[model samples]
Target: MITQLPDDFRFSGPSMELCTLTVRVADLADRFRFTLVHWGDQLGPATAMLVKLESGRDAALTEFRYAIERHGMKGPVVEVEAQDVAAVGVAALVDDVLGALRLSREDTDWIAPAENKARALDLLHWWAQTSWDDMHPRSEQRE
Candidate 1:
């Protein structure tokens, strides 16, 4: 399933079209935030958003809560180009979820490499519902 991704395929569109990585405001770039990612982004042959629960929900929850308490939050959604995502090493695809959300390298205690792709995908979905306007200035920047 990890070998079916078409070459040069970039993940675009909304959650309905493909999986999305929603990121909260704080942890979004490095505080309290979240992001969304598609399950089909894995080394697979799917073109839809994949929503799965991670076994380590406890850890992810704690991390998410900590961020909320420390940095405040917004929406749980973030648009990402994950169709080309992959787990090249032992670490699961979720390992990169933090990166995609903009979390710093120092705050990755919520996940470990000895993890699985499901974990990363799960995290992405959790934060997918987050608000991006509060964290990003895209609209303001454009003004």
Candidate 2:
């Protein structure tokens, strides 16, 4: 349950300058979570991970992207970056990544065309207002 990253953010990106990749694999918690994130660089060559999918939200459609030889993970498109799909609006997350994509189905020709698309929508509206929780489903049913 450790997934943090706020330390006065300095994620300056657009061509290198990742700035966030905290990890702490020990079967559980201690802190330093975030699995992936390199959202800016490698925009044209396909490498914008931004991941965090650990069977959360019951999987299947929480942000999409598939390819990397359809399941090998090595260029050909692997821009997953998930964990957000409620009312459906990021082009319905780009038509579910063009229907289960499969190696560079051309996700908008590898986006980032205008100032990194306004800096990736201003960092997704500042991490959706600080990783919004709204009491995370009653705080996970009171844990």
Candidate 3:
């Protein structure tokens, strides 16, 4: 499902030295979220890299993709060398994202009030998988 061109590619690597990150902040800077889509030598683990980082009691995960895609410019997609992020998990991962962006805690929120954590996580998982489904050319692919 990916094309390989010399330099005209939209995606590349399992980079041995860099991890590609996609990040977004939501709710007027009240929340922050990110995803580690690719890490050195591997794509993100099935359930480990999709956490949303936020600052207020809101559905940060719920709004993650929209915020990223809508608010994103040339800033959201970044490449981080592996040696920089020495740890992983929600806090570490978010911190890694913020660090990559050169953002500080004052610039972004790391926690938020979630109304329903379960629901928000569920929606996040759904979005992670289905976000691209709607963009598929259904009829063309059917053939």
Could you say which candidate leads in TM-score?
Answer: 3
- Residue clash pairs of candidate 2: 67-70
Instruction: List model 2 lDDT by residue over 118-143, tens digit each.
Output: 45555666666655654354555668
When 2 and 3 are scored with lDDT, the better candidate is: 3
Ranking by TM-score: 3, 1, 2
| Order of quality (lDDT) | 3, 1, 2
lDDT (tens digit, per residue) of candidate 3 on 1-143: 11111222221111111222333323223332333332232322121122222421111112223334465521222222222222232345445545534566555423322222333445455655676676675787868
- What is the clash count for each candidate, in the order shown? 35, 1, 6
- Which stretch of 10 consecutive residues in model 3 shows the poorest summed lDDT? 55-64
Output the better candidate (1/3) by lDDT: 3
The runs of at least 3 residues in candidate 3 whose Cα sits more than 4 Å from the true structure, single-residue gaps closed, are 1-90, 109-117, 124-143
Q: In model 3, how large is the Cα lDDT of residue 71? A: 53
